[model samples]
Target: MAATLPIIDLQELQQSSSSSGKLREACEHWGCFRLINHGVPVSLMSEMKKVVGELFDLPIPVKRRNVDVLSGSGYIALSSMNPLYEAFGLYDIGSTAAVHEFCDQLGASPHHRETILKYAEATHGVAMTVAAKMAESSGVLASDGAGLFEDWACQFRINKYHFRPETVGSAGVQIHTDSGFLTVLQEDETVGGLEVMDPSDSGYIPVDPVPGTFLMNLGDLATVWSNGKLRNVKHRVECKEAAVRISIATFMLGPPRYTVVEPPAAFVDGGRPRLYRPISYEEFRVMRQITDKQAGEALELLQGPAQPLSTKFDVNSLPADVLAQIQDID
Candidate 1:
């Protein structure tokens, strides 16, 4: 049997300021909610859909040729075991011009690029609004002054799921939390397979897809930013025999390398001055990569007290040497 995911009407949010309380409750308890009747144009969405479909339909060899996991800026194709099911991803490179040129070279409509930029801008604003409300609900900052995340960055990712129907039972993705602060996902309405673990029920609950709506969830950075006041729920995607699932997600993240992530003073109880040392985002990302490569050893390091700041990789502000290293990775 399929379970229903909660849907929160955007109209309600626009109608009353009190709606934030409800939004906060839903986010806290469910860790996921759908926003309906949002302002994104339907025509724009259609164009995006068309472009994405066209891109995916390209020859597998052409697709593979473009895959660059190290670029962290382009396309990625992998068969890995994450919390979600198996998937292929195309990450935006923060350059509208570059994406437009790439699409144009592939004979994609130029209008699609324009529409994507517009959508990204609008969605970024919406994410900021929601984040502010969440901050208020978590008591980290005032509803109007939840500016701790003003320097956040936004990333757009398009993911497609491929399931081999003959394969008896396969999981799409393993259970895991997103790496950033928050994620707003727009999933294909026809197919269903996304599921979130219900902390209260200890069972998986399905999230139904709705047209013109986005599924919003908290991520690891939010938990860290709020000092664990807000939770980043674990969720996974299962492969369905009936249809393939595709989703467009935008991740809103914290500031660049130099920014420090520390708990708010309000979250500190029992006189625990500051639980985390001030670590730059650059340092954290490198440490994260190392941790991913060596999970067992990373766990051991976590068990010990804070060691001095040893290694930090500023990918965003790479020096000439670092740029060369990245080119090698790319």
Candidate 2:
């Protein structure tokens, strides 16, 4: 048996901003919270679930052939088995070619494209709202001198976990933090495997599936953006009773790395000025992904006359048209 996770109401918090203090504390302690009565429409949620189920139910061979690790698109089947369960992963949705191929393989209608885009946009709006509130609670600015998460990028993924009834074991994801700033998850009502590690209690707490609500959790980039003010991501999924679990996650990435991330003046003291080296989000992400850890070792390298990373995104590779389209995404 696992300890019960806490549930929070976003409306209550909005009505009384002071309640955000408690929410912030919960995030710091548990690294996760469930948000009830969030603004997303129920119908949209239903359509997303229906389409995802239809897509995943396609033949196994069709799904397997679509996997592309290098291109960062398509279905990935159980490549990473968490300590307690088996799961699939997907990422990078902007690849039009891959999306078309996937839809064709599933024999899904062309309307699925509209459905996916609508879902993504709605999720993005919700993510922005939550991020703004979170930034306000954590005392961080959204780069536009606003309290909300402006200039944020959103990515959505669906996870399906299968279990065998007689196995009598856990079957889900391992304990790990997300790579983005924030994660909003809508899980199936029947299955329950999501768990968050309580830092203080040294025990695992179960986050039961709740209908009409979304679960919010911080990620590694969020911790960095908040300059350690917010909680670090620490959650895992476990399968019990051999029941399958399906979850949809929306990852809200923080402002571009070029935006400076430093502690607010209110939190900084005379002796404790800014500590982190200023780098764009893109640079940080790329460097973090690189196998060579030493590639980003020179902190003072930026202060000197050396060329900045921003210069690397050359005009030839990323034309003005491309940059304009990327800007329009937010």
Candidate 2: tens digits of C-alpha lDDT, residues 1-330 = 555555777777778888778777766666677887777888888888887786677688766655433212345565433223222233333334544554565556777766766676677777777776776676654553474355665555676776666544543554556656778888888887777777667677777777878888876566555555566556766667676667788777556435645445534557645445455545544444332222123232433455446724332244433322121000
Flag regions of model 1 displaced more than 4 Å.
1-4, 60-71, 78-107, 140-147, 269-275, 285-289, 293-304, 308-311, 314-330
TM-score of each model, paired residue for residue: 0.77, 0.72
- Alpha carbon lDDT at 248, candidate 2: 82
Candidate 1 lDDT by residue in tens digits, 1-330? 554566776766777767777776777676777777777776766666666766677776565544332223344444443223322233433445545544544454566566666766677767777776677655655643456667676666676766566542666665666666778787877877778877677588877667777888876666666555566667877776646567777777566655766667666678544445555544554455444522112223322367635435445554433322221010
Q: What is the C-alpha lDDT of each candidate?
A: 0.60, 0.59
Cα displacement (Å) at residue 256, model 2 = 3.8
Q: Candidate 2: global Cα-lDDT?
A: 0.59
Where in model 2 is the C-alpha error above 4 Å?
A: 1-4, 60-73, 79-107, 141-144, 165-171, 257-267, 271-276, 279-330
RMSD in Å for all candidates: 5.4, 7.3
Best model per TM-score: 1
